[model samples]
Target: MKPTEEDNKIINNRRDFIKTTAIAAAAFMIVPRHVLGRGFVAPSDRLSIAGIGVGGKGKSDIAMFAKSGRADISFLCDVDTRRAAESVKAFPKAKYYKDWREMLDKEHKNFDAVSVSTPDHNHAVQCLGAMQLGKHVFVQKPMAHDIYEARIMTQAAEKYKVVTQMGNQGASNDGTRILKEWYEAGLIGDVHTVHAWTDRPVWPQGISWSINKANVPNELDWDLWLGTAPYKEYVNKLVPFNWRGWWDYGTGALGDMGCHLLEAPFSVLNLKYAKDVQCSVGSVYVDEFQRGYFPESCPPSSHVTLTFPKTEKTNGDIAVHWMDGGIQPVRPAELGDKEIFGDGGSGTLFTGTKGKMMCDTYGLNPRLIPLSKNENLNVTQKYKRVIDGADGHYKQWVDACIAGYGKQELSSPFEIAGPLTEALLIANLAIRGYDLKIDELGEDVYPGRSAKLLWDNDSMRITNFDEVNQFVKREYREGWKSITL
Candidate 1:
């Protein structure tokens, strides 16, 4: 139809408007990746992490996440500026804060997840706070200060539906998988006894807390550093490291290496909370005449025996022995006179019905006893290995966070780590119980040393010894929040 110039112009404008509107509607129908599910981030998107304790192990942890090339270290927090200097210098673009509470409060929206590498006592509080905010967490080993805290952290992860990973990097190692495959294939049949030992406490133990308070360093926030622990004056050699020996701040030698050493048994045998535990600790002497009793510090050494109920992988109960502070199990008879047992300093040995196998720390260098049995021996790999093995731990967490909760499997998720941690803490209950004192006839008597502590996993307490239950759930200092699910 031949139309006037104005009519033709109006028709052309209407056609252009309809085409634009249809394009807009199509774009709207294409949902954003985030709307797909909780924590569902697009592949191209980078994860923004707020590190709560960015020093030492914390520093290396966040750096590993950055190495994944999928994460952005957006915020850094530490109680000590001197300790944090290297991290700040490495991640200059990241905003820095001294108090983790302030950082989480003000910048929660800016980050997608939180990495907690603080001291043992503070792990639970910081982790729970982040989970309450719907933030994923990657906490350092042991996960919590107490058994109660570990249980709460485990439940909180489920309740909040947030992804969680404990920093037991060895759980990702191929050695663990190899051991598992060997056991499942009946190469090592029905492991009934496990011995895990370490030469730890390279730091001080069985010592008295310094009475001479040192002036707080200018670069450190002493009060903040004592978070969740009882108020104590700043003492020399406590910061940066040594807190591990003191009961108030650290979990002692067992806490330091149990996760690394005992992880193999837990993974291979599916060992959970211990039903009972007993221990004998080495004592320090102030002089030849008198034995030193420093209840405030972990003993110089100890031998702990924990009994776990049978699992599908086991024929009956299992007895797991833990030794630290340079103690080790008796050398296997099959081992040659000169052959090193457990990498010289630390190792784990599994004594099964058919044969025995051993590995060094972090489940590395696994081999059968008699050592000759390792020759020409091959077991089909039943489990897929994590790329790059143990070193890939950090990237694994980053990938899981991007994939959302319940979408991917983690080597040391809280479900697994919580029980492993509780077992270690349970062993600690016996160690601490060994030092428990009661006054009788005007003289102190140690009854805990004589009893084998019975544990009730549901109640999270020692049924036989009430005093040790005090350690199961400690009292947080006034004004600091306690962990709750």
Candidate 2:
């Protein structure tokens, strides 16, 4: 209807508002190609990253990624405010959250990749969830809590077509590559046996969970920190450290150090899954009257042996020994009385028919055992070196993610890390098996001591011992199930 000037002005204003709103909505619907996802990011732009578990190792990992000069730390998530304070200070602009699930659900599209330096148990679920969302991932060592999870994460990386790397930065070190080259040169000959040892379980081990519960700290969300781990009363000193000794929270000493100490052997020997595994663990004599065995706690000491079928590089079957809790093999004759063994505290020794070779933690300072040979021999370097060596590990991954999956090579891609981690966890199965205690006819009996656990790799089971198979894929607590690929 024909109206006065004031009514006409009101109608025109309403029409302008609708037109502007529609235009803005349309522009939003047409997302910037870079904002679509990392898959479409411009090669020139910095890759965005979101870090879960940004405390302890997670803190250092994110710092390295930021230092790479090609990545952006866009988000930080951690369960404990006290532990997370440093990261929050470091990335003041990035949003923070207590639960990783909430962070990812709300901001999955904002970051191109995720760094998981959480405990061993949560690694699988976090990695799988990120991969499911088509995000690249870098997880800390001892890839997963169980054998099955390692296998699943390995497969998920390939299936999702996402760039992935395990946090075994040593895999990027020159030592592993140099050792490989030496082995290939036939100087060490075919490695028939390997001995990797660590003085871990430095935190308390060989004990039971405290029956007396302690007050949960106000700065921590006890339930969220417990994530996939089963519900339990909080114990003082358990968070941020001693949890490594508990089965529900950690994979024990092997999980803590195996990835670092055993990586070189896996790289040099071209090893895969073990054909069989057996172990003998030392008992903690808490009291002179009775030796204590805490099923929930990792043993104070252990010696595990795993036999691997010969690979293309090996002449025959090879046996690998893993010792933790301060146990180490007899000193090699090539090492002088005063010469420190495997860099003193922890080391890897590869015994060969021709000679012995050794290196310290993370495969650093690799050397031929005779000392003189290490000083005299010259071998051509055939492998590419990371820009900053060990520090390059983080950059290598960030660069790979930016370059997109399958476009660049990585040091510890799942293909290599998966089998390597599986080997460590398989050895752990024997360690966990060593703790088995069953009550038979009102008397205690140990079933794991029966015989060597025969492993059928295809089936992922101990063919002979049924009891140990339960550990192959542990049961997750309700509502904390693993993510599907």
Please report the candidate that would top TM-score against the real structure: 1
Overall local distance difference test of candidate 1:
0.91
TM-score of each: 0.93, 0.90
For this target, which candidate reaches the highest lDDT against the unseen true structure?
A: 1
Worst 10 residues of 2 by lDDT: 37-46
lDDT of 2 by residue, 181-280 (tens): 8988999777899999998888988887875579999999998888888898998888798888888878888888888998899888888899998998
What is candidate 2's CA lDDT for residue 316? 95
Cα-based lDDT for every prediction: 0.91, 0.88
Candidate 2 residue spans exceeding 4 A from truth: 1-43
Which pairs of residues collide in model 2? Answer: none
TM-score of 1: 0.93
Candidate 2's clash total is: 0
